[model samples]
Target: MNEQISLSAIKNGNINAFEELFRSLYPPLCGYALKILNDSDLAEEIVQEVFYQLWKKKEDLLITSSLNSYLYKAVYNRSLHLVEHKQVENKYANHVLNDNSEIYSIQDAMQAGEIYQIYKKTLSQLPHRCRKIFQMNRDFGLKYNEIAIKLSISVKTVEADMGKALKAFRHSLAEYK
Candidate 1:
């Protein structure tokens, strides 16, 4: 069937047309996502999510380009977003871990304890509101908007406080780096 005809059928709630399109495109889309994400399960999940969204929004769906190009672009963008999110998570984990060596000795334990002490000292030195904002984000895992709402402040204030807290930590811990 022609691409436009298939899309029209899909828009008109034709299940068979949508199934045919999915069957033809699913494998290639999964493969494309896998190449970007390097995880088979996550790639499949991303492709499935794309298709789900496509179907759910069929009534309002608008494709200015070819369907193939549109699907490929969606998969590509989602894969990249997942990769970026994972990188940020890994970066934060590594920063907290400090040393990733497999061997754990008494001296290493002592060093870690000392580092924790320094970190607490630095945290304490922050202005009261800044310290609370930092704790709300890092300790409580609250988002900036949530923190702002809880404190009756603006999101910008939360962001600025977090920036100040991080800057202080970086300055205080420069020697460790």
Candidate 2:
């Protein structure tokens, strides 16, 4: 297909033209992306996303260069962005793992254990419904509305129980603060 004619037809919302462009370019684009990304699945995904964006923005599409060059550039840019993102994630993970070793001492572990014991004791002293509400919110990560629905109580009741539980814990753990 002539590059200019196909681009024109694509701009005019011709699905056949778009499909033809996609079918012809997809493999080469994926191959180009794979050279940068080093992952077949991610390369395919990048190419697909580029095509999707092209189709989605077809009405405003403008090609100042060859369509092949444009598609290759898009795939290349996206692949590099993904690689940079992964590098950032890996750096963050490494920083956390390396930094935490120095930050936490044996004394910190002992203090944490003592705090946990105090927490458990304080929790046990709470009224049955208040303890349940507090556990639902904290341990189970349930929202107030979810806890209220599960316990067949009003949101106000859940709030009151949580407040009471928090007060008991604060009073019990005051020495640590």
Candidate 3:
């Protein structure tokens, strides 16, 4: 049947004419939506929704063009809306991820600063020779042999001082762990 005849019948509340329109137009509408959406299921769903809306609002609907034009336009707009909505959701997700990474980096920097302060306080409590040896090894990045040579001390004495410094730091900083 012609679209005009089917549309007029549907407007007059003819169920058979409505069924005929659905049978004829449903496939082409789904195909059109599929071309826009790239998903068969979503395309079919959009077409079905448009048809449902057409039926539900048939009495109040105003069409200046053919029924085919109206349905195609509806499907096109709905597909575009879905794509826009998905893009917005993806952008929001990326923003949240970036925000979380920034927060994590700030927290890491603050924690490092706190640990450095604790370490400095602990170093102050060590005996002068132990503090110097630890600083030479850790802060100045010197080897044990280099520190021993620089300080005119035996390697064994440097090792013992390093051990004492480590024991002190571990004792004072254990609460953090």
TM-score of each model, in listed order:
0.49, 0.49, 0.48
- Model 1 C-alpha lDDT per residue in residues 1-177, reported as the tens digit of each score: 688999999999999999988876777677666655667888899999999999999999999986767777787667667766664233333422343233222333334434555787899899999999999999999999999999999999999999999899998888774
How much lDDT does each candidate structure score?
Answer: 0.77, 0.76, 0.76
lDDT of 2 by residue, 24-53 (tens): 667667766665556788889989999999
Candidate 3 per-residue C-alpha lDDT over 50-112 given as tens digits, one digit per residue, 9 for 90 to 100: 989999889888999878678767876786677656632333434434353452233343344
Ranking by TM-score: 1, 2, 3
Model 1 vs. true fold: TM? 0.49
As for candidate 2, its clashing pairs are: none
Model 2 residue 74 CA deviation in Å: 0.3
Q: List the residue pairs that clash in candidate 3.
A: none
The TM-score that candidate 3 achieves is 0.48
Count clashes in each candidate, considering only residues at least 3 apart in sequence or on different chains. Answer: 0, 0, 0
Question: What value does the lDDT take at residue 55 in candidate 1?
Answer: 91
> In model 1, which range of ten residues has the least summed lDDT?
100-109
